[model samples]
Target chain A: MMLRNTSNAVYRVAYESVSKLSRKLNAAKNIDELSSVFDQYLKYLFNFNALRVHIVVGSDHYYFVFPLKDENETEFWENEVLNFEEGLLENGVPICQNLNAEQANSLIGDDVQNPVLWGWNFQYEDYCAVTSLIADENNQFSSKETEILGLVVDLFTLKYYELITKAQLVEKNKLLEEAVDIIKQKNNWINQIISDQQNVIDERTKQLRYQNEQLMQLSVLNAHQVREPLSRVMGLLDLISFVEGDEFEEEILPKMKESAKDLDEALQVVINKSIEEIVNVFDINSDKM
Target chain B: MNRGSNVLKVLLVDDQKITNFINLKVFEMVSVENQTIDYTDPEIAFRELDNHNPDIIFLDLMMPRLNGWEFLDRMKSQKIELPVVILSSSTSPEDFSRAEQYNNVLDYFTKPLQRDDIEKLLAKL
Candidate 1:
């Protein structure tokens, strides 16, 4: 009866030693941070020499050891199990046993006296975990401590699930932001292509309008300027037979020759204008291309 | 006039004076006894239309200041219904079709006017 009273008194003192739990847990970003949080608080919550926990979340197995050699150390691996963890996770039942000679020698050291080990397997909706706490005769873990161990395990495991879910949500949000950036870049590229095509179409329409005006000018030159002198030549040619000798020589022939020369000059002018028009149009087209 | 008391009075209008010379020569070759009044300036011809009192008129299509169509339009507005023969250098189908719309256009001929063509006109008169 005295041993129970002393154990209860020790637990009360440990609980009072712990200051803030939620503040520490809120600052935690990863499981490594949570590991430090648990390390600081676990000793105060329970009486144990060593604590080990193994949790399986998705395909990853998280294993941690308490009473860390360095407070700043943070390293966790997947699927790395110890010999003691195998027995702890062996069955659905709870274990409270005194370590045999060989087992005690391997876990602690051969020098340590009678060490007792306690293990429990916890089942949750998404995952399963196992935790073990070791004690010795100097620190007596009676049936009362065993009952308190259940409550402590429950609280730790619930906090661990919250931290894992928060981490996964952050990973998914980062991926979403990257996808939105790519879509914005693609939209800008499409707008640039559309504006470039519009500029090309406008330039082509301008060239076509200029060429059309040149063609109209050429047609008017062909109809009026070219045909005017040509008609005079035809008319004088027929007058050749109408007159007598000196009148034909001085009057008719000279007039016909002059009309023919006028026709030739008109044709030359038209030809020069056509060449100039063609060169100007070609220049307008090639400069852009 | 060879046919006495029925004198053929011809009015010739052309922008080119050289073209007018050729038409007048053709009229003389035809031996048609006619009193001819000719003008290189079409506006002069349009002003002297009632004074000339021509039985038949020869008109050129293309001209400076006043073209054949504009002269004809003015003549219609003045209500001068003289027989007119279009003597143009143009052989365009559109020009021929357009001349058909003028009420007093008796014939359309491309220049220079031949002796045979003058005979046909005198026969028509």
Candidate 2:
């Protein structure tokens, strides 16, 4: 009653297939991997020659049809389901229906015998599975074999939650790695800015020290050289008071004129030397910039 | 010149003939001429240091062939210890500080070497 195929002692083989399917589903890393596992194993769970399942979760839809003959692969898509599956989605319950020859031939093509269609609709939370199975007299399900159907429903729910939780965690981990990468880039940028500022400060201090030394040299030159002849002129002017008018005209007066000329020349020396030194300092600073 | 009868024998050494001539007039102003010998060339004056035998040497600092510091160094090397009064036209504090390093350098004066400077020299003498 629980497994209709037990008459052939095939329940052991079906049990092993369902156990392998559960292992494969749990071991699967992503939706694509889970889809491949389902394609390989889901048909072996029940007594059906042909199986068609349409599953909908929110806006995502998956449809898989396995017409197993000569090891044909499962055809899966967002495919349109059979007319009986539309009815089963609306009714939200199990259904046993006799599929006429035309309807049976339309799916597995005239290869079936006395084909009967069984429908199972299972819903949990926002998820729904609409499964329509066609089996002929060759591999028919007893109406009372709800135990195996119940086991399949439990596996679907468990597999769905496992893959969904993994998917959410993977999405969140990707965002976390992106955030960490942005923070590292910002830290490098901040360190670069700080180093640039330190270099600027060091350059400015060096230039100021050089300019200050140049200024001190120039000041010493001016004080000693420029002041020399000017003082000589003043000295000659003071000599006027002691000398007689005739003596002053011959001695102090001509000497005063000469010292004045010397003062003018000394002024030029200071001016030219200061300009040259200032220009040199400016050129050095310009080269650095 | 109230020089206390010791009639100070003075030598004036400067690179400028005009500066020496002006210093000659300072000696005239202080009424100490005939005791003063002036030389525009410091090297000539350094060579004639013994012959002139002056009680005081008014030495100009900046000159050709021998600068004041070198002149002082030459005098030191020759053991020519004389009372040297530096008569430079520099009012720099560094010059004032530098002059202190010479043991034979009696005083520093920025020109003109006026009658007051001569009086101070006489008093110090």
True contacts kept of 2: 0.79
Task: Point out the worst 10-residue segment of candidate 2 chain A by lDDT.
Answer: A69-78
Give me the runs in candidate 2 sitting further than 4 Å from their true place.
Answer: A1-14, A25-37, A53-58, A67-132, A142-223, A244-254, A270-289, B1-125
Model 1: per-residue Cα lDDT at residue A225: 57
Q: What is the lDDT of residue A75 in candidate 2?
A: 27
Error of 1 at B42 (Å): 9.9
Q: Which digits, one per residue and each the tens of the lDDT, describe model 2 over residues A1-289?
A: 7566565567787778878888877788776676667667766766777666677777776665654233232221226665667788788778777867776666556777898878888776767877767778988777656567666656755576667767778889999999999999999999999999999888889888878887887776677667777777888878767677699888777887887888888788778877887898889878887
For candidate 2, the per-residue lDDT at B109 reads: 93
Q: What local lDDT does model 2 show for residue A221?
A: 64
Residue-wise C-alpha lDDT for candidate 1, range A152-180, written one tens digit per residue: 55556667888888777888888888888
Against the true structure, what is each candidate's TM-score?
Answer: 0.56, 0.53
Off by over 4 Å in 1: A1-33, A68-79, A84-97, A108-113, A138-158, A186-209, A231-259, A277-289, B1-125
Instruction: Kindly report the TM-score of the first chain in candidate 1.
Output: 0.66
What clash count does candidate 1 reach? 0
DockQ of 1: 0.27
Model 2 interface DockQ: 0.52
In model 2, what is the error at residue A253, expressed in angstroms?
A: 4.1
